[model samples]
Target chain A: MEQAQADKNNSAIRPVLFCECLEKDGIVRRVAAALLGGYAFTWGFTALGTTCLVALGMGYAEAEVAMLLLAFLIFLIVFLWAFAAVRIDRVWKVLGGGAVLMTVMAWVMQHLLLH
Target chain B: MFNGFRIAMTWVHTWFGLVLGFVLMVCFFFGALSVFDREIDRWAIPETRFEPQPMPSFDRLLLPVLEQQLSPDEQEYAANMPKLHDAGKGPMTPRLELPVDEYWAYTTHRDPVLAAGGGFRVPHPKDPTLENHIHGRVTIDPRSGTVLRDDALKIGSDWFYPLHYKLQWEWKDLGYWIVGLAAFSMLAALVTGVIIHRKIFREFFTFRPWKQTQRSALDLHNMTGVVALPFHFFFSFTGLVIFASFFYFPLSHTLLKPLHDQHAVLEAQRAGLPYERAGVAVPMASVDAMVREAKRRWAARDMAGEVGFLTVTHVGDANSFVSIYRAGSDRVSLVGEGIHFKASTGEVQYEDPPRAAVSEINEFLTGLHLQHFEHWLLRWLYVLGGLLGAVCIATGFVFFVEKRKRQHAKMGGQGSRVVDALAVTTVTGMVIAAVGMLVANRLLPIDLPGKGDWEKWVFWAVWALTMAHAFWRSAPVAQGRLNPAWCEQCWALGVLAIAAVLLNWVTTGDHLIKTVFTDTYWAVAGVDLSLLGCALIAFWVGRKLMRPTTYEKNAVNRALALHE
Candidate 1:
C-alpha cells in the first residue's frame, strides 16, 4: 500500500511541459524574454504614453507621472504573459517589435513638438 | 509552454519567488528597523539622546553658522570640481573660496539636531544649467548651535535605511537596479502567488506547527503571505513607484528632456519664482520675520505647523528667494505648503497651491512608503507589516528546502544543501550581523578615531563568519536532516542580542531601570527591551530546533541505507 501511494505521488508530480520547455536553455530564454523584453516594452510605453498625453494637452509633469504610474503594471502583465504565452517567438515579437514602434512614434512626436 | 495559466503562474511564483526572496528579506527586515530610525539613532549615538527639538532661530543662530568660513566636503570637491569647472575657462576655484549659491536647513519632529548645508557654486561650469555645486553639511545642536562630529555613522539612517533600498551598494547604482529588479519580481510573485494559492482564506488562519516540516513551513508561508497580502503588494508597488521616475524609467531626464526643460521654464514663470540668479549680489533681509509671516499665513489657511525645511535659492543675490515648507507630521504626506519670499525685501513671491490629483496620489504613495508621519500606532503597524513580509520570505525559503531536501538527498544532489546554507545566512545570519554591529558600537571606545568604520567592519566580518559556519554545517542538509547551523546560529543571535543590551548599559551607563523608570528615555529603553524580547524569541526557536521529530529520523536512516 505504501509503495502504491508513493507511485501515485510520483505520477502526480510529473512535469506538465514537454522535455524541450523543461530544458535549461529553454528556461533561460523564457526568463530573459520575461525580464528584458518586458523592460523594453515598458520603457517604450512610458515614453510614447507620456508624449501622447502631453500632446493631448495634459500638463507635462502630470502626463509623465500618469504614464510612469501605469508603466510597472503594464510590465507586470507582459512579464507574466511571456511565460504563459503559447509561443516564445510571439512573445518576443510583441514586446520587441512593439517597443520599437512606440519608441519611433514618441521620437517623431517629440521632434514635431520641438520644431 | 505546455501548461495552463495556473501551472505557469505556479512555476513563476516558485522560481522567481525563490531567486528574489533573498533580496526581499533584506528590504523587509531593514525597512522594519527604519520605521524607528530616529529612535535607533538616539540609541546608537548616546550623546544625541536629548528630546526632539523644533527648528532653531535661523536669523540669529543659523546665519552665523552658514556664513562662517566653511570648506566644501573634500571628497565632493575632488570628485565634482574638475567635472563642473571648465578649467580652460579659468583655474578651479579653491574649495574654501567657492561662493555659496544656496543654503538649506532641515529638521524633523523626531530630530534632536538640525541638519544644515550650503551649496557652493562653481564659477566656470561645463554645464551651467546643471547642478554645478559642491556641498558642505553640518549637524547642529538646536539648543547650543554647536557642530557635532560629521564622521559619526548614523547607523540607523545611513546604514540600515540605505541597506533596504540600495543594499549600500552604490557602485554605478548596481544596488538600485538589483533592488528594482527584485521589487518588480516581487510584484510578479505576489500576483502569481495569489493565482497559485488555492485556499488563501483557509490558510490565513491555519498554522500547523506540529505538522511535518514541509507542511508546517507552507502553512506559515501561506498565513503570513495572505494576512499581509495588501501590505506586501502595496509596499512593493509603491517602492517601485517611488523610484520609477528617477531610477526605473527616468523618461523626463532621457527621452523627454526637451519637454521637461520647457516645462521647467514655464513652471518657473507661472509660479513667479526665478530659475536663475541675477548677477547683482545683495542680501539685506530678516529671514526670521519672513518665517513668522509664513507661519502666520499657514495659520490663516487653518493649517498651523512648524517649519520642516527652509531653503535660500540664489543666495546673496537679488533673485534669491527663501522657501519655507511646513513639516507634514500631522498627515501622511511629506513636507508641503511651501511659501517663497524675496530674500532681499521679504516680500512674498509665491505660495504653493494644493497638489493636483495625480501629484497628490503620488505624494500619498511615496509618503506611506517613506513614512514621515508622527502617528505612533501607525508606525508600529507598519513595523508589524514589515516583519510579516520578512516572515513570508523566510518561510518561502524554508518551504523550498523542506519540500526538496529529501528528494535531492535521494538523488545525491547538492541543490538543497546550497539553498539551505544561503537561507541560514540570510535569515539568522543577517540578524546576527545587525545585532552584532550594535554590540560593536557599544564596545568601541567613544573617542576612538574612525570608530564608525570599525563598527561597520565588525558587521561585515560577523556576517561573513556566520555564512562560513552555515555552509560548513550545511553538510547534514544533504542527508535530509536539519542543518545544525540553524540552531547554533539562533543561539548565537540570542547571546549577541543580550550582549548588545548589556554592553549598552556598561558603556553608556544607561541601564533599563534608569532609562525606563528614572530617566524616562523611551527611545533607548524601547531598543533595550526589544533586544531582550528578540533574545527570548531566538532562544525559544533554538530550543525548538534541538529536538528532532520522526520525519527527520526516518530521512536520516534512509540516507544511511542509501550509502550502504
Candidate 2:
C-alpha cells in the first residue's frame, strides 16, 4: 500500500506529452508517405518535372526522348527523398515544392510561350 | 555505424520493403512460373502436346472448320458487333459461345504444331478482321478440318502471365496502377537499402547459415538483395518503363496536345491507311493469301518469314486492312516488322520498315525483360533472377518478424501476428495454392461447363483458406515457438506438388518415363521434372522447420511479461 501510494504520487509529477505518437515516429503516417507521398506524388511529379525539362530543352533536337528517360530516373530520387524525410510535414513540403515549381514552368511554357 | 542518415534510410528501407514485399513476392514467384508458362501449359493440357503436321494453308483447314463451327444459319457476321475478352482475339457474339464457336479463337504455335487445348489463339471470323484486342482461343487438327480441341483457357500464359504485372485484376487498369505503386516502392527500398548497407559488396558474399534465426535471416536477406542488385534494379526500372507510356500518354495529351496529335498524324502517314472505315460493304479477301504474301516479302528480306500475329480491321468494309507480323521467335526485338494489306483487294497496302533507332532500343530493352524469343539459356537466367528476387523478398519478411517478434509480443503484438499470418499466406501458402490449381485442373471433369473458371476459383479459394488457416491455427500465440502452421502448409505444398505430377501421369498416360525419352516435347517433360524438384525442396524445408526448438519458453514469458 505504501509503494502504490508512492507510485501514484510519482505519476502526478510526471510531465505531460502532447505529441507522443509523433515523437515515437507514427507508423500510419510513415505508410502514407511511402504510398501517397512516394508513389502517388512521384507519378505526377515525374510527368511535370520531365515536361519542364523537355520545355527547357526546346533548343536541342532529341530533347523529348532524352529528357523523358532521364525524368524516369529522377523519379527514383524523388521517391527516396519522400520516404527518407524525417517527418510527414517534410514529405508534404518537398512534394509541394516540386509540384509548384513544375506547375509554374508548365503554365509558362504551355500558355505564355507556346500559345 | 548506424548514424542519423543511415537510421532514417534504414527506417525507410524497412517500411517500404515491408509494405510491398508480399506483393513483389507474388509477382516474382508467378513470374518465375511464367518463364516456362508455355511448358506448364503443355503439361497441364496433355492432349495438345502431340506432333502436328506442317503449317497447312489457313484457308484449306480453318475455312472448313469455321464453316462447320459457324453454320450457314449463324453466318450473319456483320449483323452483330464483336465483343472481346482481352485474350488476344476478336470477341464473339452470344451465339459464338457454342462449342463450335471455340474454333474462332485460334492461335498457331511457333512451330507448325496446333492442338485442341494448346498451341492456338483466337482469330476473327471469316473476315478475320477484328480490332487488335484478343478474346478467345481454340486448338484444332489443321489437316482434318475437325474440331479436335477448343476452349478459351490459357492455363499457362493468361493464368500466370497477368499475375506478374496486373495481379489478375481487370478493373480498368487499376491492377497496373497498383503494381506500378509496388514497383515504385521497390525502387525506393532498393535505393535506401543500398545507402544504409554501406558494405553491400561485402554482404554479397556473406551467409551465416549456422547462426540463430535473426542472424541467419538477416544475412540471407542482405546476401540475396546485394547479389541480385543489378537484376532487381533493371527489372523494376524496365517494368516501370514498359508502362511509362500508359501513364505518360495521358500527360502528353494534357501538356503537349499538338505533339500527341502530330504523333498520330505521323503514324497514320506511315501506316498508309489513316484508320478510316468506309461504309461500302465488300467481301474480305483470304488471310491465308495475305500471310503467304507477307511471308514472301519477309523471305525476300532474309527474315525468318513466318506470321506471329494477324490483325484485321473493317471486316465488311472496303477500307479494311490486314496486318501481318513476323513471329517473335524470328528476332530478339519484340516489335517485329510487319506488312499491312488491303483486305478487300489483297494488294500490299503498306510495309512498315524496320523500327527506328529509338524504338529499336526500347524494344530491345522490353525484349530482354519479356523473353518471348527462343533463347533457352537466357530464359533460364531470367528464371534464376526471378527466384533470387523471391528469396530476397521472403528473407526480408522473415527478418522483420524474427527481429522484433519477441518485443512485439510483449506489447500484445497484434501487428507482428498479423504480419506472420500474411507472410505464411504469401510465401508457403502461395506455393500450395498454385499446386492446388494444377491439381484442380487435372481432377475436375474436363467436359464440365466453365472448367477453366473453376480452375481459377479453386486457386483463389485455396489461397484465401490458407491465409485463414495460418491465422486460425496460430492465433492462440504460443510465444517464441515457431508456428506449426508453417510446417503444416509446407507439408501440404510438398504433397500437392508431387501429387500434381502423379495425377498428370495417371490422367494423361504420358508419364515422365515416356515423355522424357520418346516424345520431343521437352516442354511437357520439363514441367513434370520441375514440379518433382519443387516437391523435394519443399519436403526438405519442412523437415528443417519441424526440428526441436529451445527458445519457446523464454520467448513466451518475456512477451507475456511486457503487459504485466
Candidate 3:
C-alpha cells in the first residue's frame, strides 16, 4: 500500500516538473532564434538575394540599394517567424537548409553563369 | 506566461523599447525640428532675414566677380581678412569670412518665392553661413550685375541638421553608428508593439486622457504609436538603409568586387568625368555659356528649376568639365539630373538623363525623407509625425517607471529611480538644452570664433549639466515621491525660451511686432513666434508641476494625522 501511494505521488509531480523544464527551454530557444534569425540569417539572405538579382539580368548598380532594403524586411519577417514557430528544431532546420541551398546556388551563379 | 504571441511580443516590446527609448526620443525631437531647419537657421542667425535676390547670369553678373577674385589685388584683400574674434570688441565686431575651398554656383530655395523667381546664387567659397546666407555669397541683382555683400556669412545647416543626424560628432561618425543602432532597435520595438496590440485598430484610435495615470499613459502610447505607426516604421527602416552602406558596403565590395569596378567605370562614363587633365594649359571656355546651355537643355526637357550646384573640374586644363545639376524641388528624388559640359570647348558633353529604376526609387525615398520639395501640408504632417513619435516614446518611459515604481520601492527602489532620472534628463533636459542653445546663439557675440562650434558645445554642456541635476534631485524619488528635476527643467526651458526671444529682439532689433510688420522674413518671425509658444507651454507645465499631486498631499496628511 505504502509503495503504491509513493508511486502515485511521484507520477503526479512528474508532469509538473516536465512543464517547468519546457517553459525554461522555450525562453532559451526564443533568445537564440532572435540572435541567429536577426543577424546571421539576414546577412545570408541579403547575399543570396542580391546575387540572384544580379544573375537575373539586373545590373548590380540598379539592384544594390533595393536588395539592401529588402534585406532589412527579410530580417524582420524571419525574426517574427522564429518566435511564432511551434517547434524550435524545425525553425533551425529550415533556416540551415535554406542557407545551404542559397550558398550552392550563389556558387553556381558565380562560377558558371557569370563566367 | 507564454500563453500567446501577444504576451511574448509584450515582453519584447517593453524591454527592447525601454532600453533605447532615451536615445530614440532625442533623435526624434531634434529630427522634428530639422524639418523646418531653415526657419530655425533664419531665427538663430538673424542676419539672413529679408535677404532675397533673383538668379544672376553666371557670365554677365557672377563671372566678373569670380574673375575679380582671381585678380592680384583681390587676392591680397582676401589674404589679409581679419580672423573671427581676433578683430572683435563688441556688438559692432566685424564678421570674418571663412576660407574658401572652392567657389560653388548654387541656387536658392531658402524661400519658395525666391526659388520660384529663379534665384541663382554664387556662394563664395569663403561664405560659411546658413540659408539666404548674406555673407560671401555674391548675389548680383541678376538684372543689375552688381555685387551684393562682401561679408555674407552663415552657419548653414550646421547645428540642427547635424545634431539630429550625427549628434554633431563627426569623428569617425561614432554618433551615426549609435543612432543607427537605436533606429534598428526601434524597428524591433515597433514590430513587437504591433503584435502585442491585439485590438490594434481599436486601440490605435483609443486615447483616454482623462483616465488614471497608468491606464492613460498606456492609452496615449498606443494611440501615438499606432497613429503614426507607418511614419515611425518607414523612417526608422529608411534611416538605417540610407546609412547601412557604412556597415554593409564592405560586404558588397568583397562579394562583387568586379561589379563595383565595372559600375565605377560606367558611372564615370555616364557622367563624362573620366577624362584626366590633359597636361596642357588652356583658357577655360565660358562657364556662363555652359550654364545657359544646360539651363536650355533642362528647360527643353521641362525639368528646369535652378542652378543646384555647379562643379568645375580640371579648372585650366583641356579636359576640364563643368557639371551643373538642377535644384531638387521639381521632383521627388533628392538626386537631381545634371548636364556635364566640356570646360575647354563649351560643347555639351553629356545631357542629364533619368536614373535607372532602382536608383530612382532610392532617390525618391531619400527625397521623401528629406522633403526639400515645396509642400507645406506634407511638411507639417512630417513634423507632426515626428512629434507624435517623440510623445509615444517619452510616454513609454513614463509608463514603465510608473508601473514599476511601487514594486521597486518595495524592493529597494534602485531600478525605478535610475529610469526616472534618465527619463527626466532625456525628455525635459533635451528641451531645455534646445532652448538654451537658441539663447546662446542670440547672446554670443555674432563674430565669436567658431560661433556654430560654440553653440554646439553650449548645447552639450547644458545637456550634461541637466543629467547631473537629474541625478541629484532624483534621489528623493526613491522614497516614492515625484522627482523635482522634471519641474525644474520645465521652468528652465521657459526662462531659456523667453530669453532667446528677447535676445533676438535686443540684438537684431527685430521684435515680434517689427518682425511681423517688416514681414520680409516670415521664416524668422514664425520661428520667434514658435519659441514664444513653447515658452508659454513650458510655463503652464511648470506651474502645474509646482502643485503637489494627490499622492504627495495625502502622504503628508497621513503622516500628520497618524501622530495627531
* lDDT values for all models: 0.88, 0.67, 0.69
lDDT by residue (B297-359, candidate 3, tens digit) is 888887766777676665566776778887776576787577887878999888666678888
**Which is the better candidate, 1 or 3, if ranked by DockQ?**
1
Indicate whether candidate 2 or candidate 3 has the larger TM-score.
Answer: 2
Q: Is candidate 1 or candidate 3 better by TM-score?
A: 1
Instruction: Give me the TM-scores for chain A across all models, comma-separated.
Output: 0.87, 0.53, 0.68
Best by DockQ: 1
Per-model interface RMSD values are: 3.0, 8.3, 6.4
DockQ of 1: 0.57
Per-residue lDDT tens digits for candidate 1, residues B18-49, read 88888999999999999988888888898999
lDDT of 2 by residue, B1-564 (tens): 112566667766776688788889888888888888777777766666765344556567765554444332232333233432233454553544422211222233433235322111133444444432223334555556555334435577778878889898876887887777677677778888889778877887889876667667888988888888888887887787777766632455465555445555766886788464566778778878888888888888878555666665654578877777776774667865778889888999999866545556767877778776778888888888889888888888777777656555665656667777788999999988888999998898778887888899999999999999999877634364466788889899999998998998889887887888876567778888888888998999899888743344455575789769
TM-score of 3: 0.80
How do the predictions measure up, each by TM-score? 0.96, 0.81, 0.80
Candidate 3 interface CA RMSD, Å: 6.4
After the best TM-score superposition of candidate 3, give how far the Cα of residue B361 lies from its true spot, in angstroms.
Answer: 2.5
Between candidates 1 and 2, the lDDT winner: 1
* CA shift of B60, model 3, Å: 6.2
| Model 3 stretches with alpha carbons more than 4 Å out | A1-37, A82-114, B1-4, B52-108, B111-156, B248-251, B270-272, B548-564
